[model samples]
Target chain A: MTVLDIPSGIPAHVDTPAPGDPRLARLSLNQRTTANWDLREAVEGAVAAGLPAIGLWREPVAEVGVDVARRIVDDAGLRVSSLCRGGFFTASDRAERTRAHEDNLRALDEAAGLGTKALVLVPGGLPAGDKDLAGARARAAEAIAALVPAAVVRGVTLGIEPMNPIYAADRGVISTLAQALDIAEQFAPHEVGVVVDTFHLWWEPGVYAQIARAGERIVSYQVCDWITPLPADSLLARGMMGDGHVDFPAFTRAVAAAGYTGDVEVEIFHADVWAAPGDQVIATMARRYVELVQPHL
Target chain B: MTVLDIPSGIPAHVDTPAPGDPRLARLSLNQRTTANWDLREAVEGAVAAGLPAIGLWREPVAEVGVDVARRIVDDAGLRVSSLCRGGFFTASDRAERTRAHEDNLRALDEAAGLGTKALVLVPGGLPAGDKDLAGARARAAEAIAALVPAAVVRGVTLGIEPMNPIYAADRGVISTLAQALDIAEQFAPHEVGVVVDTFHLWWEPGVYAQIARAGERIVSYQVCDWITPLPADSLLARGMMGDGHVDFPAFTRAVAAAGYTGDVEVEIFHADVWAAPGDQVIATMARRYVELVQPHL
Candidate 1:
């Protein structure tokens, strides 16, 4: 009678995979989940909570100065799964794109400085004042090409995060995980791939196939929930786990089944969730992750 | 500099194709774009604006009566691309689902009666109090199975409209065109397919490929722009063409290239756009269609 045990064989369950394999414990937390905090505080908080790894953000690193970012991370014995992001390559002019690439170069430096494994990339949104999707994508590609060598030299894999099309106008132009994979496939496997964030891709149908395609290129897996009445801004309003409709367990299984051997990171975008006491949010996250996401494993 | 020119290897514009070539003109506008009218008024407005087809909402039809809805469409030389909608199958009990099926049966009858080529199905959002996406989807698929046969008997195609994930809790469980197609493909081609509404799907990364795969099965293509700072309620604030971020012309071309020769209709979901004078809205629509989408032709 349980929802997961439908007798009809329709496969509606989110919790189909049996967990308890040691891999289940490898889940990490993307530090941006607490983007409001300073780098060292995030590291200390995450370490206190026993999260295995942390995805670091760039701004805070810069705010505290890169040297401090590196020291605090090292001092805490924390692992940097990825540097927050780089690559807002789509722009109306060449100079802007070049600037984006330059910024990415520094981001790569930051990632390398912090010993991050990958530099997450969001290939800018629809170019400002431009209506050409294809052209903007080309610009983004060129920018990435410019940044790839630095990334390679730094030993930081590029994690391309294709935002949902809702952001096609002002955010990253790479709008689907599949599109990221397509671009990544053209490069060396370790050179580029994707960071699949459930919040951005929960609405996509080809998600399963894309994740499978990403395989080794699947550098990061993130979790967040989609809430209704998108805030006027559309940047915030992310629901917590079990609050929205993503079939997380099913998604987790699909990711795991596709040979992903990385950490599972919960990265929420809700302002309210952020405003709550950090300790409370972290505790809730751990509980919900286990209660809802764990069953799938 | 044009976004449309991205990866220019593919055709930059949509092909209008020959009349009767269902592949070229696949989109159908929901007269709600002219928010101030009944079915008769919408049909007349659509024709005067030079659009070939429309999706008729039930409110308008009820106000004018089916015969009138049928007559206005016929007199104005507009194709009834689809009925406003039918579905919301997820329920707290069997009786609720039965009621939903009955309602869909009525919608199918109206679609047939109105001479529309298809019935647009907006599967109900989360059952009044459930967070189970898989369950709601299963219920919807089951409802479709029950209703598709009747739709076929009436020579009407069923177009499942996958709303954006924002509506998963209140408006629809089928939240992506690809998921709809998967369910649609499971049934006879003549009975089930999908409606690709840009307002709902523009955010999806798989929109392009799904439309291509849809080919003749793409029963409807509606358009509306996503206005950021989404309204407090999900239903209102959809932008009119040329006002928001959807790459309308490109989408039109992609659907056309895939071999859909249906009518190209604009479906806007904006309160402001809807609140404006009907004539002014139509003029803007006509202008946008000509400047943006029609150019591809």
Candidate 2:
């Protein structure tokens, strides 16, 4: 079937919402969910799925060139929700740190070029052989502070994504919504903000309170379900909504009450998700969003 | 070789400290570290290794009977550092919750019989298909509250263990030291307190501050390293001290400064650790404790 054809073979359990369902108005298909799709195809697939916006990733955007990638999304009349990521600030070497800062600056420029105000920053993990978690965390904060000016100049907000603590060793040291807010609160809400990803923060006992406190500073709200018996690689542990334990309605309501009025991005990085037909993944994500999340929003 | 013989095959990289090393005065061997050992073997092993204490698990204790397990530790002159666990308090059904409560009361009695003041409480994860995280947590708190009087009568402290968020869905609902403190602080410090397991809590951004706040309420301090490429079974993700990313000296200092002057239990649950000779495991734990943790204390 063509990329535009809705998969007639979607499992019986999944609902195929009609295209342009009003309930899906805020839905944004993050590119990572359709891992096999190139930048153009992901954008077209999202458009075909009636998603109003698409979340871009820097790698795929760079492959086609950011300018062209922007044009493709613009041509499809789809908004760019937010850039996938831009931060690895925990390096100990001054030169490596400098390189990271420069890369993040470029990421800010790319986010601006893509017509998205949010640049998701995954403050990196500990340096190799370094056990100074506190020191690495301090460096992450300092790096974010350093980038605040560049982000503000570009009219982009540095969105601090507090990854799950499981990734604290090698992916992101910022591991909780409270910790993210601690750093983000250092600057004006418009210049720096937090990404409330349900998969990472759902386990937090104080998450709702933190979300409420996030208020207007909640720049991006990302969704995906956290399934258990985590595969050998914990990175692919996320499941489709309704297939896992997240109470999405409550989580979405908390974000809504916090005054975040923006595209709700669905970003999943599971192996099975990547292997699925991109069109089917979009259909599943859209249907899940409508059933599990939209009513609360 | 006899269980008492110190294996000469220990890798050269692992420091083999002298028996009864003064630096290991406060170290306790948690039974799970030597998963193959029975209650009697673990107690005798602790004695042979010159470790002053052993942390008991209910299963092994039950196998030999709590009274016999108590006598074994007493005869070996090894202090019972703490009991392995007691809480699975997140059941949604009334009868299951009652059974869990009854089981915990028996755990308290077991802790008392074993002569350990601390009973580590792993507040359970969500019931299958349950999406209410807050409800699970609340049930956990209520469960703890219900057991407080029984714990007081048994002179056993309920140590709330804030497991890593990775285990929040299946192992424990309590996922942060701060969250554990929120539940523990509701009762008298001696009746209900917290377990600071390095492997579970080292990733928390506010760990140090929470450690200070835990102060006299810190009932047990368990140590283990968190290694990467977590095996498929995240439950076996723990490693020996100094084997992974935890900074034990800093962590030990935080607990020491928090006024927790108790046996520091070495609780590892990795497959490699379990497969090793139990005597060698004890020796390695003692040596690592001396080099990586005891100095700080």
Candidate 3:
């Protein structure tokens, strides 16, 4: 189906799929997908939408207090699919690096409290005014290694997210699945792994092979569509499924073939998607998931 | 130095370094770098700036006619570094594909007449409304194979340009150096090669290794910096050297080590760079090359 077939804004009558809908058995709503919702609202929204799980972000979780956020998700009977982040440790300054490490440790604790094994780590980009890409990447690897013990102690798997290259300069230096695996493989799979986010990796020519190579090292499988005419703020360039050029069936099949049976988190970061009503956004993603991605999974 | 240190607009005194300036001996001003300059103007600009070579774009060459354009450069004692285009053959429509092939053949003839062996090929992106990336890439490979005989006859090498992934959906599907080499390697080194552009490839973790692997198959080396807060139109995201995060010294060293002895073409597409006086832009790029990239080369 073409992107034009997908509806915009809220549908007149949004139907929440049945709680036990087999199609959404492994589907998850990443909090960022509903950026307008607070921690409690996000959890309640996931439950109301009949979603089995919701991915939590540190900032929102911190606002409601980790204990309260955990209790809310538990009370709603929704699983914590993964934590939004924790890893910006490419700082060259010793003090800054220490602060990042401390922050990550706290993130791990929060992830543990949320009862999720996956803690997505966006390896920091190049330091300001620094043109040393290799140096930045080396620091990321070193930082990931340092976090392994803490991650293992908390029963959390650090999911090294390979962001799109457009963000390599200012957001994340790790820009390829192979680069992420190179570091993840250095440790036990349980201690470290990779996040396979289609939006970030769809353009990779060797993505299928890399997915296969990832095997059990795959920690989280995030889904989002890459739309063209990227927004002025590139961070919000993601589109709802079937509303962009991504071949979701092929990508989902590749991740499934890689033996990644973890929660398939739908994490969109589009300005329009954010502006839409949270329930409508959930309804659209769920419907698109069933039509475009879940069948392949 | 930071981007602030780089001068903006027209410099007060733009010196045209002598033709014998060893530091600029290998530098070629790509026509796009001076977007406003026409064929004759660009050729004369190159000569006035004491540049040894100039990269030609098809439209401008067509404006003055290839033969006339060729004579203009020849009379000015400037070499044609490479031709700007030719290759958008990923169309599924048979007629469209046929048209693309005919146009590419014409481009090959233009490159040959211009006395340049390098014909940069930007393999087209996915067909409209198509989500089949692998299918699009397969078509690109088939199209390149189909054009090989003509490229050989024209004594021109098809330099497959792997554009940054951001353009994979609409501009070019070939998004990695390895992917470009994969297609180029099937043919004789002289018949098919790859263009190594810093702006398009600086984020690749394996770029240095890929450049080394390219070896004799490397046809052209293009330079431009990737600036952040990418303009509303991503096409103009390139920055002046030292104004962005790319490490020119390392990139140029890698290309040089790859045994590339061709012109290092400066191909910026930023609005600010395009708005600046052509001579000032040329002068600035030359200075940046000498300070940041020439030493490494």
| lDDT per residue (tens digit) for residues B1-297 in model 2 | 222212223354436667667876788999998989998888888888888988889998999898888888898999888997999989999999999999998999999988899999999999998999899999999999999999999999999999999999888999999999998888899989999999999998879999999999988899999888676789889988877899999999999999888999999988777888898788777777877888899
lDDT of each: 0.73, 0.88, 0.89
Could you give candidate 1's per-residue lDDT for residues A1-297 as a string of tens digits? 533211112323343223233433665667767767777778877777766677888888888988888888878776778888898888877787777778888999988888877888987777545667777877877777777788899988998898866676678778777778778887897898789888888766557887888888988888877766565546776667766667788888878888887777878777776776665566566656776675564
- Distance from true position, residue B277, model 1, in Å? 2.4
User: What is the CAPRI rating of model 3's predicted complex?
Assistant: high
lDDT of 2 by residue, A180-210 (tens): 9999999999999999999999998779999
Worst ten in a row by lDDT for model 2 chain B: B1-10
Q: Is candidate 1 or candidate 3 better by lDDT?
A: 3
Q: Mind giving the per-residue lDDT tens digits that candidate 3 earns over A66-185?
A: 999989999998889999899999988989999999999999999999999999999988899889999999999999999999999999999999999999999999999999999999
lDDT by residue (tens digit), candidate 3, B123-175 = 99888889999898999999999999999998999999999999999889999
Candidate 3, residue A137: Cα displacement in angstroms equals 1.0
Clash totals in order: 35, 0, 0
DockQ of predictions, in order shown:
0.33, 0.79, 0.80
Interface RMSD of each: 3.1, 0.9, 0.8
Off by over 4 Å in 1: A1-29, A259-261, A294-297, B1-29, B36-54, B71-79, B90-94, B126-142, B165-190, B201-213, B227-232, B255-262, B295-297
Alpha carbon lDDT at A272, candidate 1: 74
Highest DockQ, which number? 3
DockQ of 1: 0.33
Clashing pairs in 3: none
